[model samples]
Structures are given as structure tokens and as C-alpha cells.
Target chain A: MSVSGAVSEIVAERWVERTLAAYPAEILPFLSGEHDRFRNPVGQVIQESLTTLARELLGAMDNRATAPAIDALVRMRAVQDFSPSAALRFIFDLRPVIAEVCGEVTPQLESRIDELALMAFDRYLACREQIASLREKELRVRALSPAR
Target chain B: MPETLVQIEQKAPRGDWRDPHVEFRKGSICYSAAAKNLGALSLPNPRAWQPMDADWKLPPDWKRIVLDGMKERLKKYRSFRLFMDICVRCGACADKCHFYLGSADPKNMPVVRAELMRSIYRRYFTLTGRLFGSLAGGRELTEDVIKEWFYYFYQCTECRRCSVFCPYGIDTAEITMMGRELLNLIGCNTNWVLEPAANCFRTGNHLGIQPHGFKDSIDFAAEEASEITGLDIEVPINRKGAEVLFVMPSADYFGTPHYYTLLGYLMLFREIGLDYTVSAYASEGGNFGLFSSHEMMKRLNAKIYDEARRLRVKWILGGECGHMWRVLHQYMDTMNGPADFLEVPVSPITGTVFENARSTRAVHICEFTADLIHHGTLKLDPRRNDHWIATYHDSCNPARAMGLLEEPRTILKSVCRNFHEMPENTIREQTFCCGSGAGLGTDENLEMRLRGGFPRANAVKYVKEKHGVNLLTCICAIDKATLPTLLEYWVPGVEVAGVHELLGNALVMTGEKERVADLRGELFAPEAHSVGSASEASHA
Candidate 1:
């Protein structure tokens, strides 16, 4: 393997690790340990999403590639016990992890990370809105229709 | 930033699994038991207390109360005593819990969750734990331990999926129930449980729907069903000489999707010309007390038999509900019965006596409907449900506690033409919980419900992607109430419904108007290549 490719891979692996660190320490083991997609959807999805996000950032920095992974992670986080800042906080962790692993993050990569964070925020808002609408729809149907 | 990253990454794993520490995150916990609800039931130590607060305002003798309560329970319930002593931490049940699978929290693992209570039992009761302390995996009953108990015990939905796989046959649901009972002793409880139980005790239903309100809801459902079927159905309320008393969770009359099932029940009963009465006095079949305390469970469950005897009904037929069946099938006779006043449930339409329910004298609506269909008593047109490529979710209690694995499926397959099963393991005996059962279905705990529902939703997602499945059916009221929200969050486009709702759609009611829509007011699609023929061709 080429030296640059190996370097990028190490940085991406570190990025995934740093992203997982944002969650509570209690669940860290299972999130990283369990590999079965059905048994550990949250863990598998979080890890896979971060890995994909890292790869997308390192490659073409494609919005199409990164949006889905970000959507999956952000959807899980939005429903969890996370404040908006905390939900989006992991996105910020990527820059430092990349810099520490490779001694530098290129200017283009830094901007891409920022763009990814913005997309995550958008997805997070969309999920919260969806939850609100779903709850409203449920309440409407749950109300006694004929009694009213 | 780098220092913070290092700190986050370098944080050591928790010291031991036995350490009593719980973080009360906002979305993960339930609201505290309302003081009024506890006081209404004459429970001890009624006070408003937040779970997040350091001072739980527990009684001064909280520790003694808990240990003594545990001692009394240990003597009374042999299963509890056996389960406490029997577990070997085989880890067979670890991944079986929906909460553990969803959140990946080790304590959510069934073994670890049970151990949270078992560890306290060890330190207080076992000789080795008393002598060796930490070495023997014993944990002291600190305030933090009580706090942890409240956190984790409530997290369990009491679905009992873990017990299905346990080699020692440890009933983790009982352990959770025991843990909750002990928590209640210290006035540590959730309002999601206590309020409904208190309401059930007072007004005879969880929502505290008074007799008039209950009648109104039933009248409304019957009216809607009459409009759909063009038959003016007679819904008897508190009739003294009715042969069977029909009781279902109050949610059926009020909650969405559940209301449609109520319509289904009304239409099916009318079509069959069965002699039945809907009692406003016994409006709820769900016993939230099962989630509270054993005594509370017994107190709440007695009403079913009480109403049956008072109304002089020969037998009782329960509507589509989950835990309601569990209590009726498993605990009702022992807790509230003999029920000698009620006769064995003999299906009037099919003449099939429910021998399985001869003791309890109560039959599930699925069993009743399945029997009728089996005897060819009702004419069913499966094509009515052809628009729905459906899959069935076996509600935990009905599937596990009662072993009601096939009755609902028999009915669903008979009614829905385009039906699919989820992955083999995620259905029937090994079914995944909707994650919002056991009084944890409150909006405050929505995040945990979603997390807990992920595995169920994942399986649904697989079938949805593979078969274009758009409907998820179950017979539980709680499933009807919560699965819609869970599916919307995790697997959008898959609507939730009750088995009987589909049955209502398919059941050709006598003198009924030409049907164009299923229950829930959704229109059936035009016959543009029927899914029935396509699915048959694929099978062929």
C-alpha cells in the first residue's frame, strides 16, 4: 500500500474512535465490540456511519456520500438524551482527531468537516421535526374521535 | 480540544458491574409517581419527588423497609426465591433484551439487570456475600443503589424474552417485578405506572373514564362501525343476563388504531349475533398493578371477576390486548379467582369450548375468532386486505406468557392475503418488545422507547425493504398504541394495526354497505393487479 493511503486510513480510523468517544462510557464497549447489525443496530450504525463519513471526507468530500451516514447517526442521537449542541458535538471532534493523527488537516478537509457538521445540524433539526409531527399525529388519532 | 479528546478517550471503564451508579438522562427516565395517585391508593409515603434530585425524600427507615420487604417476598414467591438463587450468569439472555440490544448498556443486559437486584439480595441474605462482601459480588444498599434500582428496573418492560432463552429458566420478568415492588416500598416509583393503577382502582379504568364516559366511547365506536357496516349494532352495557362479558384495554375505545380494532370487535360481535355485554365498570383489561406491586396487581385484577359475577355473565371474552392476556391467563385465577361464578367459555357461534381457559373462564378474542373461522362460521374475504403487504408482530406478553403463538397468526393469515413473517427469531416465542410496555409508554421516556424498539423496527425494516410491507399487525392494545410511533421513527411507511382490525375489514358483515375502505378510514386501492395473485404466483 502507498504511504499516503496508509496515512489516510490511520487518520480515518482515529476519526471513528474519536466520534465514538462522544457517547457515554457505559455503552462504549458494546458499540465497538458487537458486530452483528441486527443485534446491535445502534452500535453498528454509529460505527459504520462514522467510518463512512470519514471515508467520504478523505475522498471526494461528497455531500451525497456523507449525507446518509450523517442522517443515520444524527437520527439516533436526536431521539437520545442529547442536547442539540451535544448531538452535533461529535462532528467537531473530527478536526482535532485528524490533526493529531496526521500532524495536520488540509484546509480543504477542514472545510469539508465544517460542511459535514452543518449537514448534521440540518438532519438533526429534520429528525426533531419528524418526532414532533409524529407525536402530534399520534395524539390526534389517540383522542376519542366519536366521543368528542 | 485535544486535551478534552484525550480525557474522553482515556476515561477508564467503570470500576465494576456491581457499582451502583446511574445517570438520569432526560429522555431515558420516567416521571416520578404523582403524590395524589399514591395517596389515592392509600400507599405509604406519598410525596412529589423528582428522580433526578439527590434527596428522594425516602422514609427514614427506607433501607429496613426494602430488606424486610424482600424477605417477605422471598418467603412468599418460591419462583422469586428460586430465580434469586439459581442464576449462573451464563450470558445466554444478554443480547435477548430489546433495551440492551438498542442502547448497548451492559446493565440493560437481562443478567446484569437481574444482578442489580440479585447483588443486593446476596449482600443481605446470602452467607458468602455477607462474609466476603465485594469478593462475593455483594452490593450494599446505599441510596445510590436504590437510585440505580429505580433507574434500571423501570427500564425493563417485563417482556420476559430473556427467560425464553435462559438455561436455568430464570424468570427475569419476575425479578424485575420483585425489584419494582421493592422500589415502591421506599416510595420510589414512576407516575407512568402508579397513575394508571390508581385510576384503574378508582374509576375502574386506567384513563379514569367514568361509567358515562366509557358508555360514550363505546356508543361512538358502535356508531362508526354501524355507518361502515350499515347495521345498527346493539352494544349492551351492564346487562345482567348477558352470556359473555367483553373486556378490553380502555385504549381500544380511545386510542388511535386501537379504536379501529374496537370497530372490528363491534362488527364481528354483531355479525355473529353473540350474546355479550360491555361493562363500563370493568372497562380496562390491562393491569398496570402488574408493574407496580403484587398486592396492587391483585387489587386491580379482582375487578374482572367481580364484574363477571355481579353481571351474572356465564363467561368472559377478552378483546385484543397483550399484558391483559398475560394476567388473565397466568395470574388471574390464583390472584383473584376461583372465578367459580363464571362458566367455561363456550363459543356460541362455533360451539367450541375453550378448554384451555376452563380454569380462568376467559377466552382471548383471537382464540374466539380463530375458532369461528376454523368452524367456517364466518365468511371472510381476504382480498379486502390485499392492499396491505403485512407482517405480524407478536406482542411479548401474549406470545411469551400465554404461549398464544398461533391463534393470532391463524386469524391474520385467514384475513390478510399478502402476509409476510419477520425474521424467524424475531417473531412468536422470541418476539421483540415494542419497548413501551409495562407503563413505560409515556412521552417523557420516548427516547428509550425508540432505542428499545430498534431491534423490532430493524426486523420490520428488513421485511419492508424486501417485500414492500406497508402494514404491521398485532393484537395488543399497547402495541397498537406505541408501535405506530416506533415504526414512524425507525421504519417509516409501515403503518400499525390490530389483527382484528384486518379481520373487520375482511369479515363480510350481514346487510353491510359495499366497503371501499378498511378501518382507520384508509381507502382500499383499485384492482390494478391484485397483490394476492402476485404473491401466489411467487409462492407457486
Candidate 2:
């Protein structure tokens, strides 16, 4: 196997594993249970997105794949009862997981992880904006007179 | 790679759920009921309070009043008593709740949510509990327990998805209703529920729209429908000599997506030439009182029958709504019944007898429309709705409470060519809630609503991925109001519409102008709605 291919597999598995750890313990069983997409969507989304993210982080770092994956996972977290740090900690936590698995932090991987974090931050803000906008829309609709 | 990654902690310590220590977060809970609303209803212990405040300013003897209320209700309601008594705690219902499925909060599990009340019942009402106390799985009633009750009971949308899976057939929604009623005695209620109910009792509708305001809203919708259909549609409101009285949730007129459904109703009524009159006095069919208490539900629901009597109508026809149908189907006849003044509901156009609603004298609009289609009364061009690849969401009350499963699907099949069903576990009798039903749909509680709605949205995402489904048609007014926001958050591409909106789009109205756009003013061009292109289509 190529050195990068081996690194991607190891890093991807570690990333998914550490990310699952970040959820509350009560939810851990559901998140780590047998992967049925319909039955366990939160877990399924997290796993699928993280797997794609790990691959992208290690390889091409394609925005097309990475942005949606980041969006899917972060939107779920954004609406959950987590503070800003706690919600985004999983992204930042990836740095240490990669280092621990590889025994040394490569500058290239470090830069890629930083870039992924910025993408997640952007997604987090967008999700919050959508939520606030939705709230405003609901209030407008709940009124007696139509805006039109 | 190591066997495990990064010192994994497999088991997180589980805390005692019976501790009754609830942390009131900002978005998880709703604001307390306003004093003016409670006083408007002449309800007990009306005072301004917040869930986050240390003092709820409950009655001086709140415990005594609560226990007394529970005692009286247990004596009166056998369903509530049976639900409290018969739980085997088999955990069959633990994961069935959407909130539990989404949030993974243990207390949200159906068994535990019911147990929040059951444990207290075991302590005071049952023999084993009074004797053995903690040993009998009972805890003393404290102020903290009341807070926990307020927090968790409102968290439940009264969906009853769990009751479907239970071996003993426990109706958990009734238990929630009872819990809220008990809370109401101590004036522990949410403004979202009480304010609307107070408005409903006073001005005849939840939004407190006076007769003129209600007429203006309906006139606006009728004008919009006329413009869309090119037919001059005239609606009769509070006409004393109408054949049938139509009652809709106020949101159907006031809310978006819901307003589209109203336009659909107007077009259908006009096309069929049915002699129906809309009642502005009994304007709202959805009883927020159902969320408050049985008595309040009865008070708010009495207006429908009263208006039917005043108008000398044969029967009542209810518009698309969830809890409204629940109140109409399960409780209305019992609560305010012997509508002996009204005749059984039979469709003037189809001549089909609604025998199921004969006693209640209130027919669902879906049942009526489905009958019309069955009889080949209205001309429908399904290609008009070619823009939508649709799926049906069976609103909780209609599915579990009333068994209104097939009528909506039958209507969708007739109106739209591209139709798909969500996963078997998530549709038709086993369907999940919009998570904001039963007065939980409020701005302050958006986070919990999002989490609670996750399961339903997840299922929608499955269909969106598999079939490129763009439209979710439901029969509930609350579903119409809340599911749009829920989809916007989780599954962005899928838009929410009432079943009638699609019907309106597809209905080939007589003497109607040539149509260029669907009911929401979107183009009917199939090219604009290619499969998998819904992600880019923005809905107003």
C-alpha cells in the first residue's frame, strides 16, 4: 500500500472513533450501534460524513464532497443543546487524533485540518442564520394579516 | 492502527433519572402562561412566571392541589388511570419516541416520560407506594418534580407513536394530556397554549381574530383563489341558512403554506357548488385547549356545534388539522355531544354518508374529497402537479387517534403522478410528529423542536435521496405550519404543503383562466422541477 493510502485509512477510522466519543454518553449507544441509516440517522449521518471527511482530509480535500459532509453533521449539532465550543470541538479534536495515530503531526495534514475547521465554522454560522430566519418567517406567518 | 482509537470511553456513567433535577435551558423549554390569558379563562393561580425562574409562583398549597387534581382525574378518566397503572417497563417504548430517537435523552423515552407521572401516582394513589415509598418505585411529590413534569410533558407532542408498539396498548398522549391538565390546576402552563385558548374562548378563534378580521382573511384567500383559478368565488360566512358549516384552524387562514391550503379549499368548494358556510365565530377547529385541559377543550369545541346549530346546518365539515380532528373524532361527541340538533353528515355532491362521524356530525375534508374522487365528480388533471414528486406525512392525531390513513394517500395518488412513500417505519399509523404539535410550536423552543423533529426529517431525507421527492403533503394544520421550518433545517430541498394545495393545483376548474403557475405562484413547467433539482428550488 502507498504511505498516503495507509495514512488515510488509519486517520479516517481514528477521526470517526474520536467524533463518536464527543457525543453525550446517553447517546453513545445510538450513535455507535449497528448502522441503519433509517433507524439511526444521527449516527448514520455522523459516520457517513466523517468517513467522507477523513478521506477528503487525507487526499484531495475536495470542497464538493467535504462541504456537504461538514454541513450535514454540523447542522445536526448546531440545533442540539451544545455550546459553540462543545459543538465544534469534534472538528478541532481531529488534530490530536491524527497526531496520536501517526506519532507525528505533518504540516500538510495540520493545514488541511485547519481548513476543515474553517469550513465547519462557516456551516455552523449558516445553520444558525437559517434557524433565526425560519423563526422570523414563522412569526410572520402566525399573524392575522397576510404580508401580501 | 490500535484496536481502539484515542482512549475510547465506551460506557458513560448513567445518572438516576428519578432525581427530579431538571436544568432549564433557554431553547428547550417555553415561557410560562401569561396572567391575562389564565384570568381570561378564569383558570386558577394566574400569575406571571418563567420556567427558568426559581419561583414558578404556584399556588400556596400547590402540592395538595396537584394531588387533589390527580385524584379527581383518576376517578374520572379510566384511560388516564389505566395508562398510569399498566406499564410493564419492558423498554419496548424506550426508543419509539421521536424526541428520544433524535436527542438520545433517556427521559424522552416513552416509558420514562410516562414514568415521570407514573412514579408520583405510585407514591400517593397506590397502596404499595403509600406503604413502601421508595421501595415501591415511588418518589415524594416535591416542587422539583412539578418542574420536571412541566419540562417533560411539554417536550412530548402527544404523538402516541409508542402506544402503537406497546403490547398493552397504553395511550401515552392521554397521559400527557392529563399531566398538562394537572399542571393547569396550579397555573403551570405555556403562553403558546393558554394565550391561543384564551383568545379562542373570547373572540371565537385562537388568533383572537374578530368577525371582521376573520372575514377579511377569508376574503383575501378567496380573492387569491379566484385570481389563480379565474373563477369568481364567493364565500358565505355566518350565513344562517347554509347546508353545512365549515370550520378550519385559524392558522389555515393566517399562516403560509396553510393559506395555500385555504385557497385549495375555496376552489374545491366553488367548483363543486356545495352550499357551505364558513363560521368566523367558531373559526378555529384546532383546540389549543386540548393542550391545556379537557374542560378547556370542551369549552373551545362547543362553539363548532353551537355555530352549526345557529346556522341550521345539517352537519360540520372540518378542515385539515391534526389535534382538531383528535378532539372532533375522539372527544367532541363525548365532551359536548348529543348534537341531536344536527343531522348526520352526507356530502351534497357525492351523496356518500359519513356514518363514522354520524354521531359527532363532523366530517373530515379528506374523507369528503376522497369520496368526491371515488364518485368521479371533479375533473382533475394530474399533470398540472407534474412539478411535484410528493410524499405523505400522516400527522400523529389523524393516524394514531382517528385511523385516517388511506384517504390522504388516495387523494395524493389521484392528484400527482410522481408520488413516493417514506420508510415503512415512518409513515401511515407509525408516522412521526412535526415535533411542534400540541402548542409546542413556538419561537423560543426552536432548538428542542429541531431535535424532536429530527427523526421525521431523517425519514424525509431518505425519500429525497432515493426518489428526489420535493413536496411533503400532510393533513394537519400544525404540520403545515411547522414541517416547512423543520425541513428547512434538516432536509433543505423538501417543501411542505397541505394535501389540498396539490388538489387545488391539479383541479381543472370550470370557466377558469389558463393556468401558468401552481397555487403558490410557482410555474407548472415540468422543466423547472426536474428530479434532483429540488435542492435549488426556493419556496416562499
Candidate 3:
């Protein structure tokens, strides 16, 4: 495998191991599908894709990549007609998902994951509020328009 | 040949010899047996119904202005966004509509109905529409589209029944509101709605009827009340320091059945000896039509607070109108905050206080009447209502919108001995519209009216056929006006009356015998009181 590919696999393997360790026995039934990924020979493909996507999000150099991720989240939410409250609730759930996957990695990386998750959550909240204000202003302007 | 006398005699037929159906047909026949038994009450003709100079001219860059405005609003809330986006275009909501079931028009389909606004939002705001345009079925915003929006949005009563059945809980009422707000942005509003809204903004009533005219109407009603109750009680208007501010729709000042309800309130107030005054300003308590446009609604409601502040009244009593009660129950308190001076209504007679005080403390007329009856404040003769079998038609504004199902029925049952109910869905929160509600109660939209009113008319028809329900009682002014039109087309023989009309009939006035004999010659008797004394007694 290429060096970058191998690095991704290592990161994903570390993540899965930490997830299994951190999760309580009560949640074991829900964790069944990913167990095969850690044990089987074909697990690398699934592992590489997830880790690469996470790494890309984490390593986003400018606002463009972050924006696309935000947009994707918004679009998915819009399609489901999820309220801003519901969307924020989902963001809260993402913290535990990240912690379960990466807590056993280097403490530095675990802390970095936590910080990144928080930043994204704050950004999403800001975007939602901005959108809501814009909408209200639009309603007022439309209400006053002459052509209707 | 005095013109006023000729008009009075021509417009006002003698009560004793009039046909109930023909009396209703004349439109000017103000007194029925139900109203006469309560007292002689009459609403004033605003006497002036002129159109005002409105800002109908569109702005120079109107298209850009309206489109941008709609996009901005659509982008604001996740709840609105979700509702707008997730509609699957399923025709399930069509048959569920009283209008659609009545009219059988595909445009009445709630999904399609909402799409009138949804498609506009899509074209202006969505990326798919911006990039693909016509390929994605997006059309340019045109005058015709605006017309369609006007036509369909007003067709809705904003009843919200279809929303209950929607899997996604998508409210078409919200969509209709947005559409109307957008339409008003470009001066595309109808004369019937905008004129009334504008008049209410300026003159404190929808018909632009001034204080003198209002006072005259009240004086006439007070005279009628005096005739029946033998009490020289004045129907006070804009009287300062009154304990209660009696607010009702301007239509009640002139509409039949409604006029009697107004008198019933007056008589009950006098009987209970409560201090009250009707506002010369803020004459209307209902503005469900304004729910579609925030600006117009805010402008209209601004007077209520202003008038209350001016009069310094302690509490406001809302009349028996559906949409008016809904607006007061749900949004009025939120839109116009708490009145620190006012307390939740506590009955002077019974010492009972209204419990469900939200932001603003307002009581529906039925609640007030029901409480009075519950406390044994008023003497009733249930036998007076026994002339014909009767059933209740639930007005949409008070039922599903406000959870006011029991109060009206409770009052009706307590007053009327022969009162029967329609099917379960035909009453309560699941009740059908009279089809002429929301501002669709106009004469111009006959086809749409026929369609939207069909479901309600059909329900009334079923009751009339199976149960011999001759009198259809509801507690709304709009129903009184519109149901007559619908009954004419669908159920020919059934008649509609206000809940207060029934109560007025059953009210045991102190000097009814002397007043009845005195007015019997001047007023025709046979047409007014169709039900014989024996029939009334049997049910009593």
C-alpha cells in the first residue's frame, strides 16, 4: 500500500480499537457490524474511506472545505425537514461518536478531535441563526413589496 | 311617503306573519322568533361602504424585490424550511379538505394548493432551480403566478385540519399565510380583504363605520333589549372606566342572528349587573384573515391595545365568532402582550375565575354564558327552544384552532331542551368549515365557495335527512352569512341560527308577555315563530 494509504489504515485501526474499549458492554449489540472490519482481511477499504474523510475535514486548510461539509449537513437536514433544534441535537451525538472512535489514540489527537467537533458544532449553530434572521428580514421585505 | 319609514317598513317585515325562510331571504329581516324572544335587536348599516385609495401600484423593480424578499424569509427557520421541502405531493389531503370534498377541484388538494407558494420559494431560493431553471420545472415568476397564488391561498380557511392528518405535520395554513404575505408585498390583495383590513386600521371597524353610526346601532339594540327585558339598560360604547370591554366583529353591529347574540350579551350583562362598554375604537375582535399577513394583522391589532389603554378597561369579552376566538386564544396574547391592569375574568355573580389565563386574559362568549348558566345566574325556559329539532355546526376557528369545543355545546345543551349533535367528526376539533370562512365568504368566489363549502353542506345535509334537524346552530357571523348561501345550493330547507339566538329564545324575560302583546300587531307573528307552543312544550 502507498504510504498515505498505510497511514490512514493505522489511524482507522487505532480508532476501532479505542471504540471497542471505550464502549460499554450494554452497547455491544449495536457495535456488531463494525466488528468484522477490525477482524477481516477486507476491512482496510472501509477503514481507509472513513479515516480519509475525517482527516480531510480535520486538515481543511481554508473555509471552503468546512463550508461544503456544513452545506452537506444542512442539505441532509433540510431533506429530512429536521428542525434547527434537532440538527443541534445530532451535533451533540457526534461528540460521543468521535470520542468512542478516537479516545485511545494519542491524548493529543483525542483532544484535537474534541476541539474540532466543538468548533463545527458552534459554526453550524451560527449558520442556522444567520439563516433564520435572513428569512425574517425577507418576510418583512416581501410583505412590503409593491408587486406582491 | 317618508323614505326612512318606507325603508323601515320595507326592510323590516312584521314579525308575526313572516315566513322564517322568506324572512331569512330578505337579508334585511333582522328579527326572528329566536331574536324576538331574546329581545328586539338590530345591527346598523355602516351606511357608507366606499373603497379607499390603496397603494395598488407595483414598484419599478417589483420582480427583483418580491423574489429576494421571499428567498430571505424562506431561508430563516428550519421548521418552515422542513415543511416547505418535505411535502411529497401526495393527494391524500385533498379529500380531507372541506373545500376539496365540496368542490372536487384538484387545485383544492392541499399538496398542490401549497405548491403555489412552494414552487415560488423553490425558484427563488433553491440551488437546483437556480442552475437548471425550466429543466427542473422552475418557471419565471409572472403576474399569472401571482394571480394563482391569490386565488388558491384565499380558498383556504386556514382550518389546519389537513395538517393533523399530514404524516409530516405540514400545515397548509402556514403555506397559505406565506403566500398571502408575499402577495401583499406586491399589492396583489383583494378589495374585500384589504379594504376591510385598511378600514379597521383607520376607523376601528372593518366597514369603516364611525362612532355615531355604531352608537345608533347600539341604541337600536338597547331599545330592543329594553322592549324584551323591560330593563332600560344602555348598550354602552367607549365608556371609560368600565370593568369589561365588550369587543365583537363589526358585522355583528348589522348582521342577523349575530345582532341577537349581541343583544343576548347585553341582556345577560344587565341580568348579572356587570359593568361593560363596547369600544368605539377597536370594534373588531377577529382578524383570522390578517393571520395571512403580519403587517396588516399588526396594524389591525395595534388598535386593540391602544383602545384598551385609552378606555382603561379591566377585561375584554370576545363575542361568539370562531376566527376571532381562535386569534384571541392562540396568538393575541403573544402578539400583544399582557395587560397588567386586566385580571382574568372573575364572574361578579358566582365569584368564579377563568383558569386558563395565557398571555392575555380574554373569555369566549360561550364560556361566559356557560359559566353563567352553570352558576344559575340566568333563568332559562328550555321549552322555548323545542319548536324544531336542532343540531350544532362547529365553527373551525373555535374547535380545532382553540380547543373551545365543550363551552359552546355546554351552553347550547343547558339552554336548548331539544338540542342534538351531528356525527362525531362533524363537531369538536374535527369539525368541518362552513366553507365560507377565512375571507372566502365573499360573493365573487362562487365556484370556489361551492367547492370548499360542499363537505360542510354535505354534513348538514346528512343530519337534516336522518335526524330531521331543521335548525343548524353555529356561533359565528361568517357562518351565518355563508351557510345560508351554501344551504340555498345544497340543503334547501335547513336553516342556520346563532347559539345565542337559541339562548335568547329560551331566556325567561321578566316582562315578555306584556312586550309580546304590544309588538304582536306591528310585527308579523306567524313567520317569526314557526314552532307551535305544544311542540316547544313537549321538548321542554
Candidate 4:
């Protein structure tokens, strides 16, 4: 199997196992809510990105259509407390994941990693711009608010 | 090979509740209701302003006004005092809240959201709180506290799921209502709610359609229903001596998805041959005034009884709606009731008595139909719904407040072949809000609605991925209008429909022509086309 597909699987299944440990025991129990992704919609979203990222790397797909979906996740991260490096850091995590899964092709996946990071960063900024516009709108409404 | 990827820690360093630095967040907060809308509704202290602003333009004595408002409401609603005093902070209600579960903001927890108001209640009302202040969790009724009340109170849809799990039955809805009542004294309210309430009060419908306009819209829908059902159905409007006075959300008359549900109502009424009249005077079943203060809600609710009395109907047959039924079942009886003038609603077709709604004498259309289905009165063709693998979204108010859960599902199972449920926690009693509910369903507040809707949307996404369920059928008119946008964003391609809309597709109407296309002009079934050709020949 290609390293990207292997990386995708590990992220969806393998990495998710470890990431689940990141939350507290208080939050861990809610992973079973009826909506399948109750406590971990982001993990599903992150897992969702792997296939498209993997597909894009193999020259079988373009992220143009997929960018909005990816950007949605990035937008959440950007507005959240995650620092810029930390927010975009997940894209780069796939590189080492691939290396561990298929050690022979770690260097081969570098360009793909770089490309995905750039796209993610661009998407994050776009989301940030949307949030900024909303914030601006809120301000405008405040300014135009009915006076006493 | 590079070293292995490490798992990112999910927990924050301190696990703090309040982040004072970003308290006025752009993404997480809701926008204020506009001035013109509030003015039209004739709300007290009406003025437009954003919650994020430092200056809310309160009156000179806003503090006294709010404190008095709280004192008045506390005396009126024992639930308010009970909610304030009973909470032991056990946090069973923490994860139960959809807002907290979606946003991970600790303040979104039901206990904390209620605590915002409870804190003020403690400071002003309790002796220990008056003495100890912040030490006893009593916060002064500062302008910031008012701002917080406006922010969080609007954030709540008042679904009362928090009260369901509370041991003392301390309803957060009571707290939120008291918070909003206090906010109203300070001229803080959302425009989306007030405008609709104002419009409904003025024009007899929330959309502000005049009598002729309301009639024209229903007639246009009746014409559309004629196309689907191949029968000329005359929907009675404002005719006296009708056995039933039918009402639904005005959205059903004007919009897609909802309009189909409107068609469902028409076809079902025709098949049963029930004598029912739709009222242009009391045209709306869904009350936006429910989201506003109780006085406004009572004013809006008075019309149903008035119209029902004027028209001299036997009982009210309510259409598919969420908060509408919450008002009809829970509040309407107490507010403007003793509906003694009307007879207890027994289904004309099945002859089943609705004992649960005996006092209000209002029966949900689903409960009416579920009896018909159970009694083998209506011929429902389940094969007509082969195109849709449906899932039920229990709109919050009906499920939690009234327990009107089984009737809709019973009808769905009888009418549709493929039915799957959302996760147990997300359906019936534990159902999440449509995000835009409780008067938050406006375009300007789309971002907050989207954020608020994430948990519900996430659940739909899972069912789409696993069950290949394409249709998200609900019983709420607000759900019909808002859930489409929510689903389109989070789980694209999963279309929403009403429970009646599905029943419309599956209803075996008397003496109907050869059916090929379902409502929305889609094919009856993908595979049925081959067999349909043979049936066409046989019918000819």
C-alpha cells in the first residue's frame, strides 16, 4: 500500500486511539452518544481530511472542491485558542505518521506534506477572514444600534 | 524515516471556565435583535444594540428596573426560585446541554448558564449571598451581568432537557425566561423573535402576510397539492361551524420542504373527509412570541381560542411544529385556556380519543394520524417511499416538554419502509435544538447558529455516513425551515422533510391516477419505473 493511504488509515484508526487519550475521563465517556461522533467530530473531520490529502498526493484528486470542507475545520481551529503553529501542525503530523508506517518513503512524502500545510494555512486565513468580517459586522451593528 | 507522530493533548492547561481576555468573542456569540422589529412588537424598553458592545444604552435606573423585574418574576414562578436554590452543582446536566457539548465552553453547561442568573438571584435575594457576595457564588447585578444574561439567555432555546435530568426538576428554561424578562426591562432582546411576534400580533401570521395574502398563499399551495394528489382539495379558511380549526407555521405556506408538509395536511384531511377550516385570523400554529416574554406569548396564543370560538370548531387540529405544540400542550391551557367551549378531540376517522390533550383539546396531527394508521383507516403505501431512507429528528420542545415522541415515529413506521433513528441521546427528550430555534433563526446570526447547530449536524453526518439516510424528517416547522441549512452545511446532500411530507408520498389516496413522481417532482422509486410501465398498461 502507498504510504499516504497507510498514513490515512493510521490517522483514522491508529492515531485516533492515542488522540482519544488526550481528553479527560470526564469527556471520554461521551464518545458513545447517539450521534456517532458525539465527543470527537473534529477527529472525524481530521480523519476525513486524510483520504483527500492522500488522494491529492497520489495525483488522483485536487482539493479545490474539498478546500471548503477542510477550511471549515481549520476555521474552527483558528478562532479557537490554538496558536498558528499548533493549529496548522496537524497537517505536518502525517509526515512522521507515514514515516513510522512505511519508513522507506518518509523523504518522498515531504513535498506532499509541504503542499498540504500551505493549503491548510491558506484555508485557515480565509476562515479567519470570514470570522473577522463577522466581527466587523457585529461592530457596525453596534455603531448603528438605536440610541437612548 | 522521521520519528513517529505524537498525540496532541486535548485538555487545556488549567481547565478554566471563564477566559476574561476573550469574553466578548466574535464567533461564539449571537447578534442583537434589530430596533425596528422590537418597536413593531411594542416590547418594553425597545432599542437595537449588540451584546459585544460596552454601552447597551440602558435607562438611568436600569439596575432598579432589572432588580424589580427579577423580584416580580421570582414571586410569580416558583420554578425560578427552585432552580436557583436546588442545584447542588453535581454536573449531570453539564454534558446534557447541546451548546456545551458542541462548543466545549464550560459556561455553556446547563448548570453554569443557569448559575449566571442564579448568582444574581443569590446576591439580591438570599441572606448568605448578601453577606458573603462572591464567596457564596453571588454576583452583583452589574451591567456586565446584564450583558451576560442577554448573551446566555438568547443562547438557550429553553428546550428544558436540563430540567429533565435535574433531580429537583429545576428547569433552566425558567431561569432563562426570568433572565430574558429582566433583560427586556433593560431593552435587551433579539429582533428575530420580536419581529415575528409583532408581525403575528398585527397581521395574524409571523410573516406579516395580510388576510388576502394568507389566503392566496394557501390557495397556491392547494393548487400544488392538486398537482401531486390529482384531486382538487379545497382548504377551508375562516368558515364557521367546522369541526376542526387547523393551523401550522406560515413557513409551510411559503417555503419548500414545509410546503410539502402543508400538502400532506391537505391530502390527509381530504382522505378522512374531516370538516376542518384553516384560519387567516389565527393562521400560525408556531408562536414566535413563545421565545419572547410570557405576556407576549399569551397575547399571541389568545388568537387560537378566539378564532376557534369565532369559527365554532369542535377542537383544534395542530399541524407539524415544535414550540407551537410546546405552547399548545404546556402553556396554552394555563395561559388562555379552559378550552371548555370546544369538544375533546376524537379523530373523526379512527374515533380514538386523545386523553393526554384532554384539557387543551388540541391534538397534534401526528397523534391524530398515528391512531388512524393503528386502526387501519388510511391506506398508506410504504413502497412509494423507497427512494428515501428516512431518519427522525425530534424537535426539542415537543419531545422534552410534552413527550409527543411516539406518535410521529409510529406514523413514520407505518408510512415509510426504511426508518433509522439518530443516536439515543440525540433523539426524543434528549434531542438537540435546530440551532436557530427560540428566535435565533435569522441570517445575520448564521455563524452562531452554525456553531450552535454543530452537535445536531454532526449527528446527521454520522447517520448519512453509516445508514445512507438521505431524508431528515422532523415534526417542527422551524426544523423544516432551519435544519435544511444546518444539514446542507454539515452533512451536505441529506435533504430534510416533515413527517407528514413523507406520509404524503406514501398515502394511498382514493381514486388517484397512475402515480410516477413523488412530491418535489422526484420519481416514485428508482426501480419502480420498469413495473410502473406494466401497471400503466393494466390501468389503461
The best candidate in terms of TM-score: 2
lDDT (tens digit, per residue) of candidate 4 on B151-214: 7788887877777788777788777777777787677887677767877888888778889988
Q: What is the lDDT for B330 in model 1?
A: 83
Clashing pairs in 2: none
Please provide, for model 1 over B57-93, each residue's C-alpha lDDT reduced to its tens digit, 9 standing for 90 to 100: 9999999999999999999999999999999888889
Task: Give the total clashing residue pairs for model 2.
Answer: 0
| Best candidate according to DockQ | 1
Q: What TM-score should be assigned to candidate 2?
A: 0.92
Model 1: residues with Cα > 4 Å off, grouped in runs: A1-33, A58-62, A81-104, A129-148, B1-15, B528-540
Native-referenced Cα lDDT, model 4: 0.75
Instruction: Give lDDT tens digits, candidate 4, residues A1-148.
Output: 8765655565445443433333334454453232346644544554555455555554444668457546656755664445566667666656555566666444446766677678888887876666566545545543442221
- Indicate the TM-score of model 4: 0.84
Candidate 3 docking band = incorrect
The residue pairs found clashing in candidate 4 are A34-B423, B33-B190, B33-B191
- What lDDT does each candidate get? 0.85, 0.86, 0.60, 0.75
TM-score against truth, every candidate:
0.91, 0.92, 0.66, 0.84
Error of 4 at B323 (Å): 0.3
Question: Which of the two candidates, 2 or 4, achieves a greater DockQ against the reference?
Answer: 2
